[model samples]
Target: MTAFSAIHEEHESDKEDFTPGVEPQPTWCPGCGDFAVLKALKGAMPELGRSPEEVMLVTGIGCSGKLSSYFESYGYHSIHGRALPVARASKLANPGLEVIAAGGDGDGYGIGGNHFMHTARENHDMTYIVFNNEIFGLTKGQTSPTSPKGHKSKTQPSGSAKDPVRPLTLSLASGASYIARTAATNPRQAQEIIAEAVEHDGFAHVDFLTQCPTWNKDAKEYVPYTDVQDEYDFDRTDRREAADMMYEAETKLHEGEVLTGRFYRDEQRPSYGQEKRSTGEMPEDHLAERYFEDDPEFERVADHLIDRHK
Candidate 1:
């Protein structure tokens, strides 16, 4: 069978399919919120009927970056804050691959902020999950972009005077077609949100509130989080309503009131890949399939190069 077809072969899949046999154990600290993301992803894969081979898990440098090692899939451990770009390229090359990028607040919202904004603006077909613990967990509790104003950390000893980045609002402003927030303390909701994000055909951003118990001592475990869909009556499909609701949720998070759920979705818009293909800029065939399939143009180029070298 061809490489592309082989990986996309139909089969009965379970959560175990996403677990690496050689490295099944994760070294994350006990009570670490990163573990919840791993669980939610593994759980969501089975529900989506997506085998590990059909998925690409890209992660950036951070405690959350270890996800690539634990999950059995086409994994890429990119440099700090570069996960989104890598994921975007992979999805563009192989539109069939289910691409998911993951990183911490520092890696994504801070260092990778530019890429994140543009990718959403273009509406790339992929899922991005940011582990927002308010502080940089991997770098020993430094003040992150999402850190609350006046929040003191080792890096911000005098308490940070800058306000935190509102991720949901920023996502909406950047034109992300799908946006949501979920907490590590609520695995069921996290899994559900992940499944929905994966099913989305455009840019899907999930601001996952993961408490870093080891570094963030003052941050709560994100418990008592209310699902906005269950508690509030807001039209998630309406941009104005979603914006207002997201603003309220962002404000509430700092005030110790946690609101979690799908905040926005726009299904009418097309994904980046769709736009490119519609414009005849991107090919319908998967780029990786070139090696498995014969093409006269590719052969002509190869032969010309070989003759010149010889």
Candidate 2:
């Protein structure tokens, strides 16, 4: 493993550049919304001029976890609900690497909820995409955190007594610099939002509504949606305004109305890495490359110096 260095050759690339050859077709079921996420993500990378080598995708265990295998990039299919920690470390190790963490709602908003809050609060420079399918699709449709109140599943056969989580609002409250919601139903919108999220400087959260058609039959395909930017006019940079807007969107979503698009953006705040660098806490030389001679060329130089001194 190349201990997560970011320097790479920039070149022309396309969506096909990210697709793996000789890999099995994605196992997502017919009409599965996970396809939209893959498509949008593939499209976003090309448009952002990022090559597969320049990106690091970290994913947690779930149907979404398989995404790392399909996308031809530096990837890690970590254990359940632990993608964020792995991704945060990778980004800190290689600040220039475009890091994207992905997982299902249960894996992210439920099991890894604590990591999610702290990561957002610290404003790590990376993108976290939550596949909000409303239920655990790969695990036989068990009721999940975002599942509507009264949503019945194998775990909650009669009906779920818990209310769904307000993910977007929670992202805001946790101090995420950029927050948005996009559905797999709208591929173009999903692509645009993902591209923007990838470019954002701080913790960018996209609560993606990817429907599990095979398991979650009740979730609205997330269409007939409203883009907060285009339909509901408001200043995206305003914190209080963004909070109010997120609250409304979260409330309406469970009521069967799909609200998608950018909710909050704060370009002024520095990312965690940037803050450390500004405060002189970050060393001038990358620790992995300098102290450890992790770079091949650096190892050669050290070996030559030792021989000369002998």
Top of the candidates by lDDT: 1
Model 2 C-alpha lDDT versus the unseen true structure: 0.90
TM-score of each: 0.95, 0.91
Collision count for each candidate, in order: 0, 0
Candidate 2: residue 226 Cα off by (Å): 1.3
For each candidate in the order shown, give its overall lDDT on alpha carbons. 0.93, 0.90
Per-candidate RMSD, Å = 3.0, 5.1
Top-TM-score structure, candidate number: 1
Q: 1-310, model 1: which lDDT tens digit per residue?
A: 4678846567779998999988999999899999999999999998998898899999999899999999999999999989999999999999999999999999988999999999999999999999999988877889999999999989889999999999999999999999999999999999999999999999999999999889887777987789999889999999999999999999999888999999999999999999999999888988777767654235456788999999
Off by over 4 Å in 2: 1-8, 291-310
Clashes of 2: 0
Task: State the lDDT at 205 in candidate 2.
Answer: 99
lDDT of 1 at 228: 96
lDDT of 2 at 237: 94
